[model samples]
Target: MVEIISIYNYVMRRILLIQGLIGLSLYDEIGQGYLNEIDLECYITDIIPTLAQVSNHLHPSFERFYVCTVVKKVFFFLDHLHTRRIRIKDIVSSGLLSQLLELRDSAKSRDLVVNETGNWFSMPAVLEVYENYLDLDRDHDGMLSKKELSQYGSGSLSPIFLDRAFEVCRTYNGEMDYKTFLDFYFAMEYRKTLSAMHYIFRILDINQQGYLTAQTLRYFFDGIEEGIKAVKTVK
Candidate 1:
């Protein structure tokens, strides 16, 4: 049963990939028409440089192109999800969503160089993120040890969702090992956290000071608070 579900997921992912490629190819043409009304310059040269920079940042190996291809595939999947208005939170449980978002926020904080006192995070902080995620597994299965939990539903998720996850987990042909399960869980969670961290680091270099300090930290925290409050007010 688990094998069947895994196969199903694999197939769905492929379909999403194909659809994403189609969308990406159309993006430039569609974007141009949309941007035409605006005063912004639509020069391909200007756009290419930005793309080159981003591509370089994402991949240092231009000659060994498979890395770029894989990255594009992943990007396509994410773009499709966004275009479809499918929240990552909806695909995974709220607990997991919160964890991902928290990691993203922490990454942002780190990037913004918030808490310039060098108290942003350390080894212990990193472990805390892992521990918090494990605690959400609920079944004490040593890992998230479930597929549905990693795949579908939201909020606390229903017992039905958990059951599905467990069922999917059990479908493996061989007895699953702990390390393998942990690898799967951590890989997905860590990717989200790392992506968030990268962006956070980019925006918070206020003083060009190699490290953040107390004042910078306070300013960053206050800004986050204001943003959150504004979001809440609008909602």
Candidate 2:
């Protein structure tokens, strides 16, 4: 009976690991080729955890090994996308995101958060986005003041990008609130027009608050998105 149980556990773990690799491959293909600027972030934050959990459960020895693997792949895919300047929509239409999400429930038994760091290593891209936004809000107020926005890199942003971002923010009917600023910032960074801006706003506006204060934004963004985003941004 004991021998049988050990074999069963080993086989199950192996199966889970295989499933995770398959899922990661699918995500890489889609993320590298299809996802939109906004959807890319969503996919990273939401779907990657599901994959990591599956992998970890199957391969328990590595201590979040599955998550670490997924994160590395995600970062590579994003780097390739950026290098090629690929359009995110093209990737989505290819049907990869939906396929990846389909595996989420299968891996529900495993905890995506690793005990070592108490962090989700599977979704580094999400982390990067959260960190970038949080870094902008130095004062840590719920809202981002104009002073905070202005201090983003001393001339690191090109004149064209800065002017364009500023112009977009100005059109928000006032001094560009946090939501408006994030929308513009993402649009510029992702090289998407304003159409993608709406998605960015929706993702950041967790808690259905209709407005994203730094606090609420960080909670959801850092909790989920940060891990995913971290994958892409880390050097």
Candidate 3:
């Protein structure tokens, strides 16, 4: 089942590479336009100088932002390859992998120099949370319940939303694993673009009934209202 889902995702991503993600309709034209207009090699050359300039000047947050921007932009180039049905893992295995690996290490070293902060990187933070999950998995079921995941509301998310979200968004056995947790996190927290809101719906749609009941929406909005009030009242 897991392998089937993984392959489905892989194929969908590849199809999306060529067809554009229907969920993110705006990006469809943008991606197409990018393919038509951008000379990727030239863009890479332009960014080389910009990256060198970014390193010479730094504030911690700004440095992180700049580095992340560069990383995101570079990763965007992967879409071109994706459009060609090339898997990034294969690319990672190629001669380019060492360079890409070093590139990230250099970025990480620079980021560390800027901020000696703990667990600033995403993967490490996720791993850290994974350890926390293991500790909190009281039943040893390898699944986290609402009681266990309540702590997810510590910052950015509302406890109410988390509670209701579990009821709505559960993909399997009315429970959540690390992967599903990440999906919920990204969908609600980052909420990066308009289309990402589908994730929210997945969380809000109770009963797999294909539409949200007013009661469900009201349940979610109650969380939003509570979240707003809490934020406003925070000391």
Positional deviation of 99 in candidate 3, in angstroms?
12
**Candidate 1 residue-wise lDDT, 1-235, digit = tens:** 9999999977865565454333333434544322121111222212323333222332333222222222222222333222422233232322321221222233344343222322212223333334454555666664453442433223333333233334433334432333333323433344465533332333354566657789877766766576557658989
Alpha-carbon RMSD to native, per candidate:
22.9, 16.2, 16.1
TM-score of each: 0.21, 0.33, 0.39
Candidate 3 worst ten-residue window by lDDT: 19-28
Q: In model 2, how large is the Cα lDDT of residue 16?
A: 56
Q: How accurate locally is residue 58 in candidate 1, as Cα lDDT from 0 to 100?
A: 28
lDDT of 3 by residue, 26-127 (tens): 322445433221233333333333333233343444433333333332333343222422233433333232332233334554454433324223333333
Full-model lDDT, candidate 3: 0.48
Which candidate number would show the highest lDDT if scored against the true structure? 3
lDDT of each: 0.36, 0.45, 0.48
Worst 10 residues of 2 by lDDT: 114-123
- Name the lDDT of candidate 2: 0.45
- Per-residue lDDT tens digits for candidate 2, residues 1-235, read 9999999977865565555445444545545544333443444544544454344344344323333333333333343323423344433333333334434554543444433222223233334444565788676763454555655654244333343344434334324444455444545465453445454454455455778797865565444454445446974
Q: Candidate 1: list runs displaced more than 4 Å.
A: 1-199
Ranking by lDDT: 3, 2, 1
User: What residue pairs are clashing in model 1?
Assistant: 2-171, 108-200, 111-200, 111-201, 112-204, 115-217, 116-212, 116-213
